[model samples]
Target: MRLAIANLHASLGGARVLRDLTLTLEGNHFIGLIGPNGVGKTTLIRAIAGLIPFEGAITLDAAPIASIPPRTRARQIAYLAQGAESHWPLSVTRLVALGRLPHLEPFRKPQAEDEAAIARAMQLADVETMRTRDVLTLSGGERARVLLARALAVEAPLLLVDEPVAALDPYHQIGVMEGLVAYARAGRMVIAVLHDLSLAARYCDRLVMLNDGNVFADGAPADVLTPANLREVYRVNAEVTGEGRAMTVRPTGQI
Candidate 1:
C-alpha cells in the first residue's frame, strides 16, 4: 500500500500542531519521523490513523482515507501510540485478540483464525511468554511489547507507531525495530516516530523531520541529519559520522 499525506494540517484544543505537512510512503518502506519533543510527530501519526480530525488529504493506494469510516481505517492502519494506557486487567492474549474486532461480526466471539493471528503477533513481538499474564502486572517494556503485539494482531498494511521503543531496553529496542523491518520487507509500510537519531538513521529507509508544525527535512538519513539541520531544527550541536551504511549521530551540546 502506498500512503500519501497532502496539505495536511491539524489542531488540538485550539493549538495548531501540523501545518500543510505532506509526504509519501511507499509500501515496504520503513520511514522514520523525528524531531524535538512537541514538534507534532505524535499528532501527525494520529491524524494519519484517523484518530483525530485534520485538514487536507490522506490516501492509501490513492484511495482517500478521509472518505473511509474510522473502523474501516483502523483495519487499514494500525496504531501503537506512545504511553498508551491499558488500565483494565485484560490478559495479554485476550488484549491482543481485540485487534480482530474490526473483522468480526457484531457480538461474535473470536474464532480459530483470530487465535492464530494473536499467536503470530505474540511471536513476532517476542511477547509469547507473557501471553497469559495480566497486562497491569507487566513492566513498562513488557507492556510496550504487548501493545505492539496487539497492533500486529490487526495485520494492517500500514503501521503507525509513536515512540514504540521509548520504554524498551537496547536489546528489546533492536528486536522491535527488526520486527518492523521484517514487516516492511513483507510489503507493508511502517511509520515510526523516533527520538533516538542513531536508531532512526540505522533502521529507516527514509527520514522526515518536523519543526514548528511543518516539515523541516525529508529524505535519506544522511541528507536530513546533516550538522546544519541538527543545529537549526533541533537546536543542538551534533556530529554525524560514518560512511555508506554505517552512519551514527552524537550530540555535542544543547543550543
Candidate 2:
C-alpha cells in the first residue's frame, strides 16, 4: 500500500502544528518519526489517520483518504495512540477483540479468522498471559502493551503507533521494537513516534525528522540521524556512531 501527501497543513485549537508538509509512505517498511517535543509528529499521524481536520492531499493507494468510507479507512489504518487509558473493566482479551470491529458486521460474533488475529496480536504484544485480567487493572506498562495488541489485532496494512515503548522497561522496549520491525517486514507499514533516538536508529530502517512543522530530514537512519541534523533540529551537540542497523545517537550537550 502507498500513502501520498502534499502541501499538508494541520492545526489544533487554531494553533498550526504542521505546515506545507509533503510526504509519501508505503508498506513493507518500518519508519521512525523522530524529533524534539511538540514538533508535529503526532499531528502528522493524526492527519493521516483522519482523526483531525487538515488542508492538503492525503491519499491512500492513490485514493483520497477523506473520500474513503469510515469503516473502510478503519480497516486500512490501525492507530495506537500515546498514553492510552481504559477505565472499563473489560477483560484484556475482550479489549483486544475490539480491534476486529472493522471486519465484523453489527451483532455478528467473531469468527475463526477474527479469533486468530486477536490471538496473534496478544502473543506478539506479550500480553497473552494477561488475557483474562481486567484491562483497567493492568499496570501502566501492561496497559500500553494491551493497547498495542488491540491495534495489532486490527491486521491493517498501515500501523501508526505513538510511543509504543514509552511506558515499558528496557527488555520490553526492545521486544516491542522487534515486533514492529517484524510487522513491517511481513509486508506492512509501521510508523512509530520514538523519543529514544538510539532505539529509533537501531530498529527503524527509515527515519523522518520533523522540525518547524515540516520534514527536516527523511532517509535511512544513518543519513538522517547525523550529528548536524540533531544539532539543528534538536538543538543538541550530539554524537552519532555506527552505521546502518547498528546506528546509535548520543546527545553530549545542548547546542
Candidate 3:
C-alpha cells in the first residue's frame, strides 16, 4: 500500500498551518517528518487522519481517504498523536483493545482474534507488564508506548505517529524507533514526526523537512539533512557525520 498526499493545505482559527504540501509513502518505508516548532508537522498528520478539515487529497492504496468516514479511515490508518492524553482510568490492555473497535460489528464483543491482536501489540510495544495497570498511573514514556501499542493493535497498513518518542528516555527512545522500523520492514507504511535529527537520520528511510508551512527538503537523510539545509531552515549550524548505515548529527551553533 502507498500513502499519498497531494496539494494539501490546512488552516486552524483562520490561520493556514500547511500550504500546498505533497508527498508519497510506500509500504515498507519509514519516513521521518522534521522541522522547527510550529511548522505544521502535527497538523499534516492530523489532516491525513481526517481529524481536521483540509483542502487536499490523502490516498491510501490509491483510494482517496477524504471520501471515507473517520471510522472507515480508522480501519485503514492508525494515528498516534503527540501529547495524547487519557482522562479516563482505562486499563492498559483495555485501551489497546479499543483499536479493534473499528473492525467489530456494532455492539459486538471482542473475539479471539481481537484478544490476540491486543496481546501481540502489547508485547511488541514492551508494555505487556503494564497491561493491567491504570493508564493514568503510568510514566510518560510508558504511556507513550502504550498508546503506540493501541495504534498497532489496529493492524492498519498506514501508521502516522506525531513525536512518538518525545517524552522517552534515551534507551526507550531507541527501542520505540526500532519498533517502528521493524513495523515498516514488515510491510507497513510508518510516518513519524520527530525533533531529534540524529534519530531521524538513523532510523528513517527518507526525511521530509518542513519550514514555514511548506516542504523545505525531502529525500534521503544525507541530502535533506545537509549543513546548508539545516542552516537555512532550522537557523542553526550543524555537522552531520557517519557513513555506510551510521549517521550522527551535532548542532555546532546558532546560524
Candidate 4:
C-alpha cells in the first residue's frame, strides 16, 4: 500500500489546521507522526482516512481517496481514534468484532473468516485472555489494548492510531509499542500519532515532525529528533542519545 498526499489543506470549524502539506508513505513499516498540540497530526490522519474534507489530493495506490467508496475505504484503513473510551457494557470480544463491519454484508452475522480475524487480532494484541471481560471495567491500558484489537480486527493494510500509549503505565506502553512494531513487521503499515518522543524514537522506523500545519522534518528518528528540532519545533532544550530502539530524547529545559 502506498499513500500520497499532495498540497494537502484541511480545516475544522472553519479554521484551517493543515496547509499545503505533502507526504508520501508506503507499507511494511511503522511511522510516528510527531508534533506539538493542535498542529494537524489528527487532521492529517482524518484526511487520510477520508473522515474529513481536504483541499488537496490524497491517494491510496494511486487512486484518489475521494473516489473510494466509504466501505472500501474503511476496509483499507483501520483508524483507532483518540479517546475511544466507551461507557457501554459491551464485552471486549464483541467490541473487537465491531471492526469487521466493513467486511460483512448488511444485517449479516460474523462468518468464519470474520471470527478468525477477531481472534487473531486479540491474540496479536495480547488481549485474548480478556476476551470475555467488560471493556468498561478494564484498566486504562487494558482498554487501550482492547481498542487496538478492535482496530486490528479489520485486518487493514494500513493502520492509523492516535496516542496509542496515552495515560498508560510504562509496561503497558511498551507492550502497545511492541505490538505496533510487530504488526508493521508482519507486512503491514502502521502510523501512530505520538507525544512520547522517547518511545517514538525507539519504536518508529520513520518520523514525521509537523509544526504550524507543515512538515518541519521527516526521516529516521535520530535525524528527525535532533536537539535543534527539539528546540525549534517543541521549544525545549533536549538531549538526544543512542540510536534506533535504544535512542532517547530527554528534554532538559523549555526553550
Candidate 5:
C-alpha cells in the first residue's frame, strides 16, 4: 500500500498548523515522524486518518482517501491516538475486539476470524495475560499496551500511531517499539510520531523530521539526525554512534 500526501495544509482554531506538507509513504517499513512540540505531528496524523479537514490531496494507492467511504478507509488504516484512554470499564479482550468493527456486520458477534485476529493482536502486544482485566483498572503502561493491542487488532495495511510508547518503563518501551518494527518487517506499514529521538533513530527505517510545520529532513537515520539538525530543530546537543540498526543515539546537552 502507498499513501501520498501533496501540498497539505491544516488549520486549528484559525491558525495554520501544517504548512504545505507533502510526502509519500510505502508499506513494509517503520517510519518515524519526529519534531519539536507544536510542529503538527499530531495534526498530520489526524489529517492522514481522515479525522480532520485539510487542503490539498491525500490518496491511498492512487485513490483519493477522502473519497473512500469511512468503512473502507477504516479497513485501510488503523490509527492510535496520543495518550489514548478508555472511559468504559470494558474488559481488555472486549476493548481489543472493537478493532474488528469495520469488518463485522452491525450487531454481529465476533466471528472465528475476528477471534483469531484479536488473539493474535493480544499476543503480539503481550497483553494476553490481561485479557480478562478491566481496562480502567490497568496501570498507565499496561493500559497503553492494551490500547496498542486494540490498534494492532485491526491488522490494517497502514498503521498510524501517535506515541505508542509514551507512558511505559524503558523495558516495555523497547518491547513495544520492537513489536512495531517487527510488525513493519512482516510487511505492514507503521508510522509513528515519536519524541524519543534515540528510539526513533534506532528503530525507524526512515525518519521524517518536521520543524515549524515543514519537513526539514527525510532520509536514513544517520543522514537526518545530524548534530547540526538536532541543534537547530531540537535545540539539543546529540551524537549518533555505530551504524545501521545497531546505531545508538546519545544526547549530551541542550544547545
Candidate 6:
C-alpha cells in the first residue's frame, strides 16, 4: 500500500501552516517525521489522515482519500493524535477494543478475532496489566501506552502516530519505539512524529526533516541528521556516533 500527498496546503485560524508539501509514503517501514516546534508536523499528519481540510490531494492506493467514506478511511488508517484523551472513563480493554469499530457490524458483539487483536495490541503496548483499569485513573505515561494500544488494535495498513513517546519514561519510551519498529517489520506502515532525535535515529527506517512547513531532508538517519543540517535548521550543535543498527545522536548545545 502507498500514501501519496501532493501540493498540500493547510491553514489554522487564518494562519497558513502547511505550504506546498508533497511526499509519497510506502508501507512496511517505520518513517519518522522530525523538526522544530510549529513546523507543521502535526498539520501534515492530520492532513494525511483526512482529519483536517487541505488544499491539495492525498491518495491511498491511487484513490483519493478524500472520497473514501469515513468508515472505510478509518479502516485504512489508524491515527493517534498528540495528547489524545478519553473523557468517558472507560476501561482500558473496552477503550482499546474500540479500534475494531471499523470492522464491527452494527449492534454486533465482538468476535473472537476482535478479542485476539485487542489482546495482541495490549501486549505490544505493554498495557495488558492495566486491561481492567479505568483509563482516567492511570498515570500520563500509562494512559499514553493504553492509547497506543487502542491505535495498534486497529491493525490498519497505515499507522499515523503523533509524538507517541512524549510523556513516557526512558524505559517506556524504548518500549514504545521497539513495538513500533516491530510492527513495521511485520509489513505495515508506521509514520510517527518524534521530537527525540536519538530515538528517531535509532529506530526509524527513514527520517523526514521538516522546516518551515516543507521537507528539508528525507533519507537515512545518518544522512539527514548531519551536524550542518542541525545547525542550520535546528539552531543546535550535535554529534552523530555509532554506525548501522547501533547509532546514537547527542546534542552538544545551542549553535
Clashes of each: 0, 0, 0, 0, 0, 0
| Model 2, span 1-255: residue lDDT tens | 998999999999899999999999886899999999999999999999999999989999999999999999999999999898888999999999999999999999999999999998998898999999998888999999999999999999999999999999999998899889877888899999999999999999899999989999999898898888998999999889887667778899996
Residue pairs whose backbone atoms clash in candidate 3: none
Q: Write the number of the candidate with greater TM-score, choosing between 5 and 6.
A: 6
Q: Tens digits of per-residue lDDT for model 6 on 131-241?
A: 899999999999999999999999999999999999999999999999999888878999999999999999999999999988999999999999999998899998889
Q: Rank the candidates by lDDT, best first.
A: 2, 6, 4, 5, 1, 3
Model 5 accuracy (lDDT, Cα): 0.92
The order of the candidates by TM-score, greatest first, is: 2, 6, 5, 4, 3, 1
Cα deviation at 147, candidate 4, in Å, is 1.1
The residue-by-residue lDDT of candidate 4 on 33-96, one tens digit each, is: 9999999999999899988999989999999989989899899899999988878899999999
**Against the unseen true structure, what C-alpha lDDT does each candidate score?**
0.90, 0.93, 0.89, 0.93, 0.92, 0.93
lDDT of 6 at 1: 81
| Per-residue accuracy of model 1 over 62-128 as CA lDDT, tens digit each | 9898788778887888999898868889999988888888878899998898888888888888998
TM-score of every candidate relative to the true structure: 0.94, 0.98, 0.95, 0.96, 0.97, 0.98
Positional deviation of 11 in candidate 1, in angstroms? 1.3
Return the lDDT, model 2, position 104: 94
Residue pairs that clash (backbone atoms under 3 angstroms), model 4: none
Which residue pairs overlap in candidate 6's backbone?
none
Cα lDDT, model 6, residue 18: 89
Which segments of candidate 3 are over 4 A away from where they belong? Answer: none
Candidate 1 C-alpha error for residue 129, in Å: 1.2
TM-score of 6: 0.98
For candidate 4, give the lDDT of residue 190.
Answer: 97
Clashing pairs in 2: none
